[model samples]
Target: MSVCKVIVMGVSGCGKSLIGTRLAERLEVPFFDADDFHSQANVAKMASGVPLTDADRSGWLDDLAELVRVEQKGLVLACSALKRAYRDRLRAGNPSLQFVYLRGDMDTIWSRHSSREDHYFNGRTMLESQFRALQEPEPDEGAITVDVSELPDRIVERCLSALGAPDRTGES
Candidate 1:
């Protein structure tokens, strides 16, 4: 079966938007950036170089989960699913939902984040805090982690190829 519902997840500036959009295009699904769902307070907090607490993110995550819950067709969402609990919350929307965890080191992601000119991500402080909060998905989580250093097309290709592959239970 083709990729129907997926989330491209990682820390901020990990190319979630670019890769998620491409993956959505490849899968013929609608794409959404989780940042678009953030409340103004969340944006303002991040803009001021403050890291968001779990409390700050609670409602935002719920909104994103609701987006997943309501979509009947293929859906691709780019979100910073840093914690396992957050991913679990998102999964409550659809149990079969797949995740594409963009894995990258601090230096690489910081480089990318620094180059960006038009986002609320204020400085390295926010990035560092994200690293602190990140809970990389384990083998059992069913997330396919992809390295972000590769070219965009190659990353998308790998995602599609992996998503097309069967899991441990041999179900597609």
Candidate 2:
């Protein structure tokens, strides 16, 4: 079977990890959360409520791009790819990379953020910065945009359908 390389992208509170994990399981592929690949300094910066500048993220973006290149078996990655440039960087060498943008307004995401207990992205300022930085994929980009207001399973199904991949979500 052919594998699907998917990137579930959005701002911090938009459920990229949750949806990406579910989508990977349904697609029968490995899953990767880009948060795990962040540098210690980047983690510390976020933990301290400091937003990362492009310089801080350049290396991280390169690392994620490398992951897409090296993980030839195909995998789903959850990342806050908030800039068009970052997405372009990820697609630099891997043209088959598919992006699933989890789109939601600040109010919608803020509610989800407030309920999460373990995430280090606790400051509203960070959220604002992310929103300010986000560049939703354009019409010609061939990226799928899903409403974050939907249930996680539904979002996964939507992505599968859009990608022309069978939904093996086992939902009966």
Candidate 3:
């Protein structure tokens, strides 16, 4: 399989990690969580139901960009790159970067978030903020936006297809 870097990006509860992990496994590459790059203070603030300002996210975005820049081979990264500016930052140093946007309705996201347990993003308070901050990827942005209501396997299939994977015509 040809290697290519992809970022599974979307709002909170949009299954960025789940899809990114599956994509990584399918591509035989490492998976990185952008959340892991956040500073302790950022995590603490989010845990406390605080919305992060663009200034607050600058460092985190830079770190993610660096990861993309330094990866010798393609890797999958899960990040809530909600804003165009943030996405641009991630793509700045890595000209070959591609984004797979896990798009979903607000209601669907809220339902998923509500059912989850022990996540740092507590499903409430930040939903509105996330939506407010979201800037849909333009056609010119070169992102493949997929609705994430499908099963994990199907999602993975679609992502692989988006990445130009050949048709096997065997598995469901």
User: TM-scores, in order shown?
Assistant: 0.93, 0.95, 0.94
Instruction: Let me know the TM-score candidate 3 reaches against the reference structure.
Output: 0.94
How would you encode candidate 3's per-residue C-alpha lDDT over 1-172 as one tens digit per residue? Answer: 5558999999999999888998888787899999888999999999999998999998888889999988878899999999999999999978878999999998999999888887788546798789999999999999998988988888889888878966755654
* Model 3 clashing residue pairs (backbone): none
Q: What residue runs in model 2 are displaced by over 4 Å at the alpha carbon?
A: 167-169
The TM-score ranking, best first, is: 2, 3, 1
RMSD of each: 4.6, 1.3, 1.6
Give all candidates' CA lDDT scores: 0.90, 0.90, 0.88
Model 2 clash count equals 0
Candidate 1, 10-59: lDDT as tens digits? 99999999999978877778999999998999899999999999999999
lDDT by residue (tens digit), candidate 2, 1-172: 4668999999998999899988888787899999998899989999999999999999999999999988888999999888889999999989999999999999999988888888777588899989999999998888999999998878888998998886465662
Please report the candidate that would top TM-score against the real structure: 2
- Which regions of candidate 1 deviate over 4 angstroms? 165-172
